[model samples]
Target: MSFINFEILATSIVILCRVVIISLERLFPYNAHQSLLRKGFWNDLGMYTLVQSFVLSQIIFGFAYWLDGITELSSYGLLSSWPIWGQVLLSLVVHDFYIYWFHRWQHHNRYLWRTHEAHHSTEDVDWLSGPRSHSLEILINQTVEFAPLILLGCAPETIAIKGMLDAVWGMYIHSNINIRSGVLQYVINGPEMHRWHHAIDHEAHNMNFGTKFAIWDWIFGTAFFPSGRKPVGYGLGDENFPENYFKQHAWAFRRFRKK
Candidate 1:
C-alpha cells in the first residue's frame, strides 16, 4: 500500500475504535447514567477530531516529507528489516516512552505549559477532549515526539504505524467511559489514570503526564493514586479563558508576554 493509503487506513481504524468503544460504553451503561451517549457528544467528537486531526496531519506530514529527504528516512524501511509485528511493538514502546517525558516537559516548562493549558481547559473528559489542543501546541508536541523515531532510523511506515497506535490509545484513555482496568492502570495509562490527570485538583494538575504508559510516571515518582477517590472535577483553576479556540490560542501568548 502507498504511504497515503496506509495513513488513511490507520486513521480510519483509530476513529472506528474510538467510536465503537465509546458507543458501547454508552449503550451498555457500566456506570448507571450512560453519560457517554448524551446529546452533543458526537458533535463534539466530529468537530474536535476533524478540525484538529486535519490540521495536525497536514503539518506533521509536511515535516515528515522534509525529514525523509535530509535523512532518506522511511519508517517502512526500518520495519521491513525486522519481523512485521516486532517492528510495530518496538515502535509503540519507544514512542510511548518518548511521549512520557515530552509530556512532562510541557508541564515543567512555563512556555510550553502555556500552549498545553488549552487542553486542560475543558471542564469535562470525553473522547473528543483528546483532540481539543492548540494547533501550535499540537505541532510542537507531535514534532518533538516523532523526532526520536526519525533520528533512530525508523522507516516512515513504522513511524506512521506508531502514530496510529498513539492516536487510538490517546483517544481511548481520554474517553468518558467508566471502564476500569484495575492493576493494569499502573502499567499502562488507561481512562481511570488519565481522567485523574485531567482532574481539577491541584495535586492532580501536573501528575500522570505520560501519554500511553504509566511506567515512566512510576519510575519518576510523579505518579499519584488516592484510594477510593476520583477527581472531584476537571480543568484548570483561576485562569478562566474564553472557549473560542482562537481566543484560547491567543490567551496562551498573552500569558507568555506577561511572564
Candidate 2:
C-alpha cells in the first residue's frame, strides 16, 4: 500500500483506540473522580496533541528523508529481507529498551528533566494526557524512533505500523482505566505501574521508567507497585506549572532556581 494510505489507516486506528480507551475509563476508572474534560483539557488536546503532533511528524520525516539523502543508507536495504512483522517488532523492542534507559536518565539529570517536566506537569493524566508533552521532548523522541526505520531500509509501511503501536501503547499506559493485568503487568507496562510514575508522592519519584514493556523496570529495580493503594495526586505538585501550551513550552527554559 502507498504511504498515504498506510498513514490514513494508522491514524484511524489511533482514533478508534482512543475512543475505546475512553469508554473503558468511564466503566472502570482508576481515579473515578477524574473528569474527561479535566483542567487544561483543550490546551492538551488541541495544542499539544493535535497541532504539535502534526508539525513534529512532518519535521521528523523531513529529517529522516534528509539523513537518507546524505548517507544513502536505504540503498543498502539492511532490513529489507525481514518480514514486515519482524521489522515492526524489532523497532518496538529496540526503541522501548533505548527509551527505558533514556527515560530513567531524564528523571535523574536536572538539565534533561527540564525538557521532560512538562509531561509530568499534568494534574490529570488520561489518554489525552499522554500527548501533552513538550515539543522538544516529542521532537527528540520521535526523531530517535523513526530515523532508524527509514535509514535501515524498512518498508515505508513499517513506519506507520510502528507509529500506531506507539500511539496506542502510550495512551494505554497513561489511561485512567483501573486495569487488572495481574501477571501480564510483570511483562507489559500499563497504567497500573505508569500512573504512579506521575504521582506527586515522594516515594514514586524516578520509578516505573519503562514505556511499552515493564521488564526494564523489573530488571533494573526501578519498579514501584504498591498494591491496594493509589497515588494521592499527579503532576509536579507546584502551583506555578503553566496551563497554557506556549507557556508550558517556555517554562522548560527558565533558569534553575537557587535552592
Per-model CA lDDT versus the true structure? 0.73, 0.92
Tally clashing residue pairs in candidate 1: 9
User: How many clashing residue pairs are found in candidate 2?
Assistant: 0
How many steric overlaps are in each model, in order? 9, 0
What C-alpha lDDT, on a 0 to 100 scale, does residue 246 get in candidate 2? 92
Residue 90 shift from truth in candidate 2, angstroms? 0.7
RMSD of each: 3.4, 1.0
Clashing residue pairs in candidate 1 are 74-155, 74-156, 75-155, 75-156, 75-157, 75-158, 76-155, 76-156, 76-157
Q: Give residue 181's lDDT in candidate 1 (0 to 100).
A: 78
User: On a 0 to 100 scale, what is the lDDT of residue 252 in model 2?
Assistant: 90
What TM-score, over all chains together, does every model reach? 0.82, 0.98
What does candidate 1's lDDT look like per residue over 1-259, in tens digits?
8889987888799878977977865764333443654433553456556776777877876786688778775544654567546776776677678777777888899888887887887766777678777777778767766665665555567777877776788777777776767888788887777888888887887888777888788889888877677777777764567666667668887834544
RMSD of 1: 3.4
lDDT of 1 at 69: 72
Residues 1-259, model 2: lDDT tens digits: 7789888999999999999999999999999999999999999889988899999999999999999999999999999999999999999899999999888888889998988999999898889878888888888899999999999999988988998998999899999999999999899999999999999989999999999999999999999999988999999988998889998998999989899
Residue 99, model 2, lDDT: 95
